[model samples]
Target chain A: MQGVRIQQEMSLFEKLNILSDAAKYDVACTSSGTDRRGDGKGIGNCKAAGICHSFSADGRCISLLKILFTNECIFDCKYCINRASNDVKRASFTPDEVCRLTIEFYRRNYIEGLFLSSGVLKSPDYTMRLIYETLWKLRQEYHFQGYIHVKAIPGASQELIQMTGFLADRMSVNLELPTAESLRKLAPHKSRKNILGPMRLVQNKREENKQEIAVYKHAPRFVPAGQSTQMIIGATPESDYQIIHVAESLYQKFQLKRVFYSAFIHVNEDASLPARTDEGPPLLREHRLYQADWLLRYYHFSASELLSEKQPNFNVLLDPKCDWAIRHLEWFPVEVNRADYQVLLRVPGIGYTSARRIVKARKFGSLDFEDLRKMGVVLKRALYFITCKGRMMYPVKMEQDYILRNILDPREKLPGGLGEMGYRQLSLFDDVNFREVKAE
Target chain B: MLKRRFICTDTTIGILSAIYDAWKMDRTDTEAGIPLWGTVQHEMFCEYYEVEENERKAGAVRKLIRERLGKQAYSDISYAILSKDEDKGTAILQTMVAARELADSHRIMEHLSHPAVRRVFEMSRNVGREAHYWEEFLRFREMKPKILYAEITPQNQVLPAIADHFADRFPLEDFVIYDKNHASYMIHPRQKKWMFMTDHEQKWEAAKELSEEEEAWCTLWKGFRKSISIKDRENKKLQTQNMPLRYRGDMPEYGKS
Candidate 1:
């Protein structure tokens, strides 16, 4: 192909542009979940709360140097921009080139670490071996102790995956689509079983490594930052209920660290995919899913509690937490001075940190609304649901419509596209902006 | 009762020395206050005193807080003293006095209902957050002779707060982080301990000379940053919200080279 022929003359600048542009669709750019000192010998360290070195125009945190090792794929995934059938510019970085870039970038403090993903080159095993070699060089030869997040090719052998896992801080295998049926329609080359196989392997190996480290204090850790996965939303017709249920089970069954939801952006057109429109990606639905995902991980909530088969979608007008609080109004007016930490968490505006702070601070004295606000509780939202010293922040009735209308004020900030929808009741006949507000 | 107000310079040792004198007075919370020098608002029926700032009195107060109120509170007070707030000194003094009423003096941080303790908590949080921001946004450039030089215009005195982090991360490299706001430098020499220097007379003209390879690497980084952004999902509001415009001045990707 012309792209292959031009690769020989491409400069490092051209290669970086093409590769990072190709890898921009990836949603996981975090450098969190690992804490390691530099050992006073290497070049970098990991902070538990990851540092965002910069942010891109898309507003995503540029924590790592997110790039594909090569844009040469054998698979013909219809949704992928770099699919084999596509005629995009293809470039591959040699192992030495990647190491040089990582070490130089580390010295400049431009990035936290490296996020090395790749397109399948020739075969899954071949691509996995290249990734392994690149990581091995970065860790041993370069003495780079910074964070590394590598992708484990779905069909790669178990031995290669385990070898790469030891050197990486995090590993991931993309679930592609939420369900297996949708996976077959969109990504014919990727099977659900093939994707879940490596995920299960990493989990089991991590468990075993934990026991090993318990016995041997300095035993080398395997995937010290744990593993995460991402799935495309709005590409298929999966409901938010189905999507989060799948995420819940993955967190429970596979013990994954994070399950990222990427709003499907139209990069390629195919017969089975949704028709392209100028509405752009479903960012509002993606935002709601992330909010609900945080609810599952930190707020001790279940997928069933947030959504169900009857209401299998998030409200475009309200967030999942506020929606839940509105539906379950019987649990309102929770006494701030008396509520348990879990109960305070269930309040609309109180977060995990604020809840903990409230629980700790109330031990000294009973908290009022001012103290609650000082402790980081959003009183404009929490006032409707909480009471301090047996009196609410405002003298308002506790009714569903009244509270919902007040909470959904036009001034309250909504995610990007949803701001134009206004505060009107959802009428069955009014589908004027249906394409924009469509919940995935 | 006449209120006794002790005044000192705006440094960690200065604040601690004021606290030492305040504690020695053993006056009630309403009768004693510690304010920074040049920021004290004189009031009637108030006896103003200039504190004799020294390392010995500061050491005594540091030891007292660390031993009585615990290391966590001591660290909080230390960070609070680094803040630019004029009332931080009085807050730390009142917070230390409040700890005496607690059954477990070490748990004074949990007494957030007290206004002075809460003020200390807020100031420490603000200083620590600014320090963390410096850790993320400070960009190092390769200067002549292979020295890594970075310049930051931080709002607080965060050079001391972030010195250990950068020193530990780049132990083998010689780097200098100059704080433009504080007129100081944190110099970490190769394989040696990091030290703070406040020599305003030192010429910095030579440090501006960049290495030959610096521009090339910066161009590559700028290109990578531009391409990695998905144009269809561009949201300048969110971008500015995540990385504020103030931090963009030192970053090469945001530079106009």
Candidate 2:
């Protein structure tokens, strides 16, 4: 372990070059998830966009230098660049190098904080120990009370993982593959057990911290941004049902902050890897996963109700809600003013924001189309499902055909629509000119 | 594409008053005409009117916004109009009119909920959210001139909100938050004015060596980072979604450690 005094050896410039270059591939540090506040001391705070910088060529936001400790590896994960056998340019940072770079970049305001991940340097614990040392120095010696999002190395020791919670604002353990069997095939060195062991430990610790925070006024700090994990969508053959099922379990069991869906991009062309070339990253599928994920997280929808092993994947044309609403048409035609909160949440057009608004405004008076619009209900989706004052806006007749035409027919998605990529690609004038290009 | 111009010396208030006066003069039977601030070609059909800087008029306009649209609405809409949204001008006007018509404590919120109002509110609210988050995410270290500097290239105009937010949140500090896309500053929290600083003036170098103390602090910071994550439920997309790469340079959460 490089002592804290290693800062004198490398200038902040050199540290930034090495660490930021190292951090470029992590694909973590999406900062909008957390809600950390400004204490009386310290100069910086968090923003929803978390101070955007630039986007990578693949249309993903480069919010942080998503990089790793070193490209050297002991494992041969088929999809990974640093897979032990690959001959890529390798780099590793002493704990001191990482600490120096972080402080330097942080000082220059070129970055938010570090998203430090590693490629099994010697072992998970060995690499994690260096990371732990780096963070310890940043927080204690520099008194840097800013955002820090670190990665929890799978199979790392419990105390190492625990120390991360105290030091960083957010941390993540990536679920690279949705299914373990597929993971075994694609990433042999990485096992389901090694990946999830530290995850479970972190889950338990955060739970304990949450309980303490709830019961007592104060508790020893945990990740204020909380713990999150990433899953590569469309890489393996796992269905959306399988993805959601795993996600729901994670949320319930581990209390994860978020479950990010990275539509797998075949960064390297490895034949052994389940080739993602034909489909690229299933951007549309990934978009649907996010919609379904949002439903699970905010709309209180259950995995069973949304999909099953029989019907594994979500339909690309229709959204999760519309698809569900169409299947269970018996639940439709609920009067806006009368439906219960959970029932209201099930409506196709109504979102958490709109549903809450509907609840508030309906208390004032019965809602009309105008009122629904005022209440932030996305009428395009809502109109097919709900009735105002017990009367459907359109003639109430054969429901399946109508719902299918409106919601399902546009699976490939019509032009000028609000579907993820379609809407953003609106005007030719709106190329890179429109900067909020993050697909998530 | 001839249009009126006003280089109001006062802040957003003066500009808003000029907008109000221009809007009043351009009323037709059905559609209202507004000279969107910077896009005019100064053609023959469109008359070019210049408005002088007037604090009294600015005050009068501020009073009207408060009386009609509530107090916070002025800043909210002014910031919205000055924001980088393509539809900023019309949105500000529509929200302003909508707020005036509603004229209650929750009027701005009511407009925030209104579809047309929400369109603008969402734009500005998003801008505001990013700016606010940038404050927390931004990591700044010391440089020459005693200025704590950070740079960003956001999708929206966020300096004002970010600057104003940093002031309340990080009071008694001297900093310059710059947007690289558009050369502007969330200027001086201490000075309380929006200004611009060129790279030459700032003389800031991005990468440098940290002090021994700083290195120690970074390691501790990473140690704290190590503890926060529960590995089981990680979602890379969600992490990327919040802390988009575009905003990373300024985020403290993802800086080096």
Candidate achieving the largest TM-score: 1
Instruction: Give residue A107's error in model 2 in angstroms.
Output: 5.1
Instruction: Please list the residue runs of candidate 2 whose C-alpha ends up more than 4 Å from where it truly belongs after superposition.
Output: A1-26, A38-43, A47-51, A103-110, A211-219, A267-272, A275-277, A390-398, A408-440, B1-160, B168-173, B176-257
Can you give the TM-score per candidate against the true fold? 0.96, 0.67
lDDT of 2 by residue, B164-207 (tens): 55564454456667677766555554545445555557654433
Worst 10 residues of 2 chain B by lDDT: B27-36
Q: Against the true structure, candidate 2 has what lDDT? A: 0.65
Q: Which residue pairs collide, candidate 1? A: none
Tens-digit lDDT track of model 1 for A177-213: 9999999999999999999999999999999999999
Evaluated with lDDT, which candidate comes out highest? 1
Note the Cα lDDT for every prediction shown. 0.91, 0.65
- Name the regions of candidate 1 deviating beyond 4 angstroms: A1-7, A422-440, B27-30, B200-206
Docking class of 1: high
